[model samples]
Target chain A: MTLLEIMVVGVLGLAGVGMYGLLISRNLIKIVVSLQVLVKGAMLALIAAGYASGHINLAQSMAVTVIVADTVVAVIGLALAIQVRRRFGTLDVKELATLQK
Target chain B: MLNAILVVGAVVGALQAIRAKRLLVSALWLAGCSAMVSILFYAMDAREMAVIELSVGAGLVTVLFVFAISIAGEDTSDVRAFVPKPLAWLLVLISIGLLGWMIIPTIGAPIPGVEPSFSEILWQQRGLDVIVQSGLMFAGIVGLLGLLADAKVPAKETAAQKQAATSIPPPPKALSQSPAIREEAHV
Candidate 1:
């Protein structure tokens, strides 16, 4: 296989693993970390796809949008984490299971 | 040379996020990983991607993480003993399987081209992705609202406090008190 394809595949594979890990984790912080993996994976995929299209502006544009949106999302996540800590005193998702409302 | 540096950095960042004791340190490590990944993008000739990752992944995300760490302080859990044995083994096995699957299929696909216009596909061809991205943004907003409400401390002793507050009589006027004072003096 070509070296380029190998990198794309590695990015995709690891990104999926990172996302899956994020989904199953009981810790809120780990979940966020997993989300980082997923975001990175998506970014890589966009870049890989762009590279595939060869000099297309459309793919590049999408990658730019993804990065900006990622920053916005991460900011919102931080806000939520702050709120969670204030109310729960911990970042454990397991505590959420016991919550009534 | 740059790729090697980025790859090594990625490994170190991953380890820090995984093994670091403090959530602050872990968040910082994740941001570092994001920076390395962005550098990798630049090396791969994805300039726009590198720009976005640096801004969002490392810049905005790290700020959010800092806010979280400030809110959370330190976690005193046994840092070393996290992730049970079964789970760790499962993660390892699953990772191996996934790597194998991804590499195998990629062996036959056409090599990627360096296109500068991937955004065209999203807006022009795959318009649905925009809708999905918007939906995701909306969902996150809703989640934030939920967090705000969740963080609120419920007022304690509500019914009794309200009842007592409502039942209490207004204080006697000074004019009314003067007569009572004179009567007591006379007695």
Candidate 2:
């Protein structure tokens, strides 16, 4: 496989790992980490696609925007998670579900 | 060779993060994964993105995760995954198959070009996107602040609690005086 093809496969594999984490992790924080892994894979794929087309700058700008957005989202999500812990006293999603009921 | 190594390292880190029993260990693994991916971006000639990923993804995001872990308390159980390990592996295999089906056909196919230079693309062609992104970032800051604020004891509640004792009446008598409290008082 070409380098681009390899990178694409790698991206997909990384995303797959992330999907597994997202599906199987019971901790809210773990779920957030899984989402970050998934974002990393998508960012890599975006860079690879732009590199293939020789639009490195366009890809870089988009990646930068994504990074900024991801940072904001992660911070907000973490803050929310902390709030949840304070309100519910546990980070377990199952426990939180029970609390909601 | 370097690309392959980086990809493998990234994959390992991601997997380790998922399997780690402690939340802190998992977060560090995620940082490692981000670092490896940033290196891969650099290898792919996306230098600016590599830098941004290294800083924001590895640095800031890790710090945030650590803070969250500290606030939320550490992982409680060593074995609390949402699904069985075999089922998770099966899901990953299915995802890999789907990805292969989706990406294989597009390889080596020529994509249309965008002729503008970096600055031109950022400032001219994508000006609107940049503006919108900035607005979204501002909203994120506001949202974080709002969430933090809501988590605290509201200022109004504290101020009301500090009201003059003469105007508010003593606590014991006030409890007996209010109809809502009187019914619940059972005295």
DockQ (C-alpha based) per candidate is: 0.32, 0.62
By summed lDDT, the worst window of 10 consecutive residues in model 1 chain B runs over: B107-116
Q: In candidate 1, what are the lDDT values of residues B70-94, reduced to their tens digit?
A: 7667664652324665676577567
Candidate 1: docking tier: acceptable
Against the reference, the lDDT scores of all candidates come to 0.66, 0.84
Off by over 4 Å in 2: A99-101, B109-114, B150-187
- Tell me the lDDT of model 2 at B167: 75
Q: What's the lDDT for candidate 2?
A: 0.84
Per-residue error at B48 for model 1, in Å? 1.2
Q: Across the candidates, what are chain A's individual TM-scores?
A: 0.82, 0.91
Interface RMSD of each: 4.2, 1.7
Candidate 2 clashing pairs, residues 3+ apart or interchain: none
